[model samples]
Target: MSNKKEQLFDIGLFKRLFQFIKPYNLVFSGVFGSVILIAILGVSTPYLLQQAIDTNLTNRVSEGFLFFILLMVGLLFAEFVFQLLFIYYSGWLGQSVVKDIRVKLFNHLLRFKMKYYDNSSVGVLITRSVTDMERIADIFGQGLFMIFRDFLTMIVVSIVMVIMSWKLSLIVFAMLPVVLYATKVFQKYMKTAFEEVRNEVSNLNSFVQERITGMKILQLFAREDVENENFKTINGRHKKGWLKTIWYNSIFFPIPDFCASAVTGLVVWYGGLASVVDGTATQGVLFAFVMFIPKLFRPLRQIADKFNALQMGMVAANRVFKVIDTTSQIDDTGKHIAKNFKGDINFENVFFNYVEDEAVLKGISFNVKAGETVAIVGATGAGKSTIINLLNRFYEIKSGVISIDNFDIKEVTLHSLRSQIAVVLQDVFLFADTILNNITLNNPEITEAQVEQAARDIGVHDFISSLPNGYHYNVKERGVMLSSGQRQLISFLRAYVTNPSILVLDEATSSVDSYSEQLIQNATDKITKGRTSIVIAHRLATIKKADKIIVMDAGNIMEQGTHEELLQIKNGYYKNLYEVQFLKEEVA
Candidate 1:
């Protein structure tokens, strides 16, 4: 979200980018050495041509002509070799640096709290990690080293021109100020233009990603036409963003070309008059200066084009660094290592809010003994699920203390804390991988036999075996290949394999067929046998066997007791909720 526009030549940004290249100093050094060699060889070629014309051809020296031609061929071969080295090594360095940065960015993302993700766009993050990283690499491969090589070539050629014929070189140099001034203006415009293009690209990515993810809703409501029109509008903006860059190029490129031509003309005229007047200027010198004019302006033109890449790289680096610099990660300041937790959860005077002054859990307090089945029932947005989030430390409480087994939850390592707890959410997510991999999550310690045993215990073994590949069947992305019920079953198995000390089920069986509901109920009963379990349910009948029922309404615990005991209260919250669900079941 920190999409600030940066200066074109941000020294701070370059300095940070160079840090990734520290490990590959040897490769980068080789690339720099190759550029220097290529520049020297590049300037030598035109000078060799001047020698051929003056010493070999003019005097009609046969042996000297052959020797000069051979020397020119050798120089060309050497330039080719150095150019190849420069290209290959620069590419290698760029790729290596990007690989390191991509990994670092991903690791940083892993540390961010859930709240950070709640406020961020998935599309923009994707662009920063993928597309932006590519642009940063281009700084080295296409922009940085190439620009250095071209600039050095120009300097070497300019110095040689002055030494050969200072008068002609002066004529050529006279037009440079105009071209340089034009280049400066062009670069400034391109910077703004490229930044707009990058922003549009991120927007387009986000729109498409959201649409595809919600395709079901769009089709259910028959909103395809409306969505398409919206897409066209976004697509138009993206196109316009790119056209701005093209427009600037059209206006800037011709100026350098014209200046180069005019300087060539001036050099020819002045050299021709001088050669005739005193025979001081020679054909060799004039021709070499003509060649040198393009060499000087060619890179100027290219630097103008390559500046686009450079600007883009700087913009990308800014965005990427912004994400890297974010400090909104879950504070893992706890040094305690949780071992064999008794699952005695306690929430003391807890107060929390997702946003300021909008409390979701108002001075809430609760306790669950070890190996107790605690079912929390409430209406939607009544803070039932919020308790689960707090218990898992996904969000820090605004004020309160959460403890397990008399130890503050925040005083333990996140890995140790989370490893002892498992949660099965309402909406299960499965990766595009095999059923076995999804179940065990590729845990090397959890063997295939154990996964199968857990699956059989949950009565899903037969269903999995009915498929062609049994446990090896691919579920595809988000488990689209499987039914919702089947996906839920897979989730149950995934959690069961972990064998955590505490288990949480948040409306896990609310939306499913009777068959799947039955399977999930049986799986639930088997998994929650001895471990401390907390179930948030909409169906009151499903939790009738719970040891304790905590009825929540408007972020407060209105009633807490066994199902029978709570139903006995006069017009109690749990009693009314139970009767309403019972009536609905009777009607169905």
Candidate 2:
């Protein structure tokens, strides 16, 4: 959807992509050597035929006729060898380039700040990383190099024709302007068409991805018919975008093809006049001209198609580079390391927002002493989760200072800072993988025995062992095979196994049944003991014993005290919130 200013052929795109080939110069040279050798061989084969006919057969010298046939066969065989080299090497280079670029792009995505992802679509990024990358590969394998081969063939063949008979060659050359004009127009239109098609593909991918992910909601509301209609409209636009390129191809291809045929016919008429009527040409030369004209012009039609490919590749590269070139990564210029990181934390006058002038946290200030458990209780939009996000440096604070163990968080490497903390959110996500793998997250240091120990430590070992295949049970995509509570338990097990110095439980018990909640409560008791803990308590009754409790509403802290201390205040915010929750529990 970006206005990247795609050209019929982008020299900058080529130059940029060409750098990927530099790492595999040997393979690239094979393609280069093949193209040149094949070009030379193309001219040689036809030239051999002209020699055999004019020198031997016409002169009635049959001594080396078989030798000429053998030589031509050898030239063809050599051309076959280089053609094989061209295919194998070009294909190898294309895949290698795409692999490198995909890895680089994904790694760049890893470093991007959460703000970029907060505003971007996952489906569009996937299309750029997966689909557009494949198109870029074609630019190397089938698009540019093949076009180069055919072009060199045409150029060499045309020159040979001109040298052989300038008059006949000039007549054939006259048709060239028409073919070039058609190709230019086709390329111009195809660039626009391909760009539109790529845009539609991105839209379709985003739409389908979001719909499928929320298919539960769609069917729950019985909106299938409405969504289906939406799909048809998007798909129709994609079809029309492709049809525009087809329309150009249909009109463009025949022009070069017609020119080839027309030039051949003109060669026959003109060759006859020069050779027979005026004695300016020979039968052998006439035969050579017949062979040369098609070679000179047919590739123009194919170039139009390859140019289409080059344009598509350039368009994809532009989109991909936009992401690769994004400057949204968190600053990692910290010269300090969080040596033996303690969980002591402080925030001074922090001001933040996801959008301009729409602050989510306004000059909020709080602190947690090392090894103490502090609970933050708030309504849905009271900025509980954003605090933890800022703690992890997931987003930058607009105006604030946050420190851990008296060292400013920004003065530590992200890895060093984040390594000391573990978080379990209200919603849990797991990969389509083994239960044990999900728990350890494929950490080589955490063995199956260690995972079992951690699970037992958290009191969820029985639940996991009860499942079929025990530790090896595959959770399936996003842990769909497990119930929501079961997934949350796995998340607990994951966080526990890390043995983090700081632990954050973000409304972790809000969605589970009583039994699951009890199990989580038990895990929470074990994980929080002697560790610095921050709990976003949705159920006010759950945090009575905390060392300190903070109540927040509308991005500001309304109350802060121990449970009994806050209750002693007359009509305090915490007392009212606690009373409301206690009444709700009594009614239920």
Candidate 3:
């Protein structure tokens, strides 16, 4: 369900991830040194226990006993301090790395073309940014640190164990491979379970987000119960997936301890025999081996858990890479500016398809002079919106050339090209911020005067002033707190504030009441006065006064003329749409 094959992560990916941490090399070095100290302290504690038992308990020297006790206390204190340093710095490194990744991922996401968002789910995107980041950070903050400490402790203890008595050490260490094999086998199942859980969580998140965002529509349509049932079904699936993971953990968590206990029993029995036969293994040595035995199993278990964390991190890393690795289909050369764009647009022999299977715009050729107002009227799926998208460079034309003021759009930087065009589409999106911020989104340098002017021109100035905090009034998410008319007006102001050379209005007035529509239409007239405007809508009243009307059908222009001329034809798409809207007005 990941839609990606599970694969092993190699050094190259980690190296790239490590580059983020390289900037904090000092912190890493501190953590590394502290971990080494902790490992030394851990390995030394068992030897100190041996020294206490052999030198103090056997000798019956009060001074030796006191000295051994004090040394043990001091070493314990040192270990605690080293651990504190290790944890603090490791946590710092993890948090810093998370911050850096989030910033880089966000910046890269912004650079992606529109098509990326079109193909990806919003829920998954948010999850990658938020949930996946935490997983990656945990790998470093907890998993990697555990691996370092446990592995070093295990290594140092192994060397000490062999130096103390190789025969006894071998007996205790024999169970390591069995424990490792068991963990490896169980880890495969855990990974599968975790991946399933992650996928189900993403699905559930997408479902909740989609429904909550459309709650008003669901309620209006009286489908709340239907949506609730659908959500319940999805949530149940997610719960089952998580329960499988819990079941896996319940089995996997206890095996390492069982293996360690079995090894400890073997060590005690074998060391007693060796001591009885030739006094080869002392009681103190057996005590030390007992301590080292538990220490050995501790790292093996940690290694397993850390390995699991690394795998989860890799899964998340793959998603982040998937987003960053995607190449934008809309490639801009970052040059070829139309410095003094007169908005003379030309689409010559243009052909486009959202996908290769079918064409949306076929052999479309047209031109719009500077400062001309062009109204496009067509039936649904007649490629009206596709034309606007092509002009905006949202999608690449399969085979054609679109030029602005004789400069090819593909040859120019998308930023520069888009900076010169302002579009207000039918589905307006408002950020969760104040109304003022939404209006002057692109022009953050806009003065209070400019904001007020744009708001007044769009006829929302009075309504905004009536709000409790005037322009500072919160819009809520997607402007849900305001009426549809208010949202449309704010979107219009946003487009108007830019004052672009070319303006596109795609049914900007379609969903609003007649009064709001008329007010927006008037603002549209003012904004389009000194700029080229392309209006795509079905409402005939909105474009009746346009300088030119383009009537399209099946991706080809059927008529091109003024509204009066198109109406004179009596059989064009424009005439039919006009008749329908006229009848509707009469009925109302």
> Top lDDT: which candidate number?
1
lDDT by residue (tens digit), candidate 1, 173-221: 8888998899999988888888899999999999999899999999999
Judged by lDDT relative to the true structure, which candidate is superior, 2 or 3? 2
> Residue pairs in steric clash, candidate 3?
none
Candidate 2, residues 1-588, lDDT tens digits: the string is 444464356677678888888889988887888999988898887788888888898898999899999999999999899899898888788889999999999999999999999899988999999999999888888788989998999889888887888898789889989988888888878888888999999999999999999999999999999999999999999899889889888888877877888888988888888877887877778888888877777678777788887778888988999999999999998888764667898988999999999999999999999999999988889999999899999999999899989888899899888878899988899999999999888889889998999889889999999999999999999899988888989998999888898898885666679988888888888888998999988655557758999889989998898998999999998889878775577467
For model 3, residues 263-371, the per-residue Cα lDDT tens digits are 8898899998887789888878889999998899978887877877876776677667777777875676757765557889898999988877698888988899998
In order, the Cα lDDT scores of the candidates are 0.89, 0.87, 0.83
> Which ranges in model 2 have alpha carbons more than 4 Å from their true place?
1-7, 586-588
lDDT for residue 52 in candidate 1, whole number 0-100? 87
For each of the candidates, the C-alpha root-mean-square deviation to the true structure, in angstroms, is 1.9, 1.8, 2.7
RMSD of 2: 1.8
Worst 10 residues of 1 by lDDT: 1-10
Candidate ordering by lDDT (highest first)? 1, 2, 3
Worst 10 residues of 3 by lDDT: 1-10
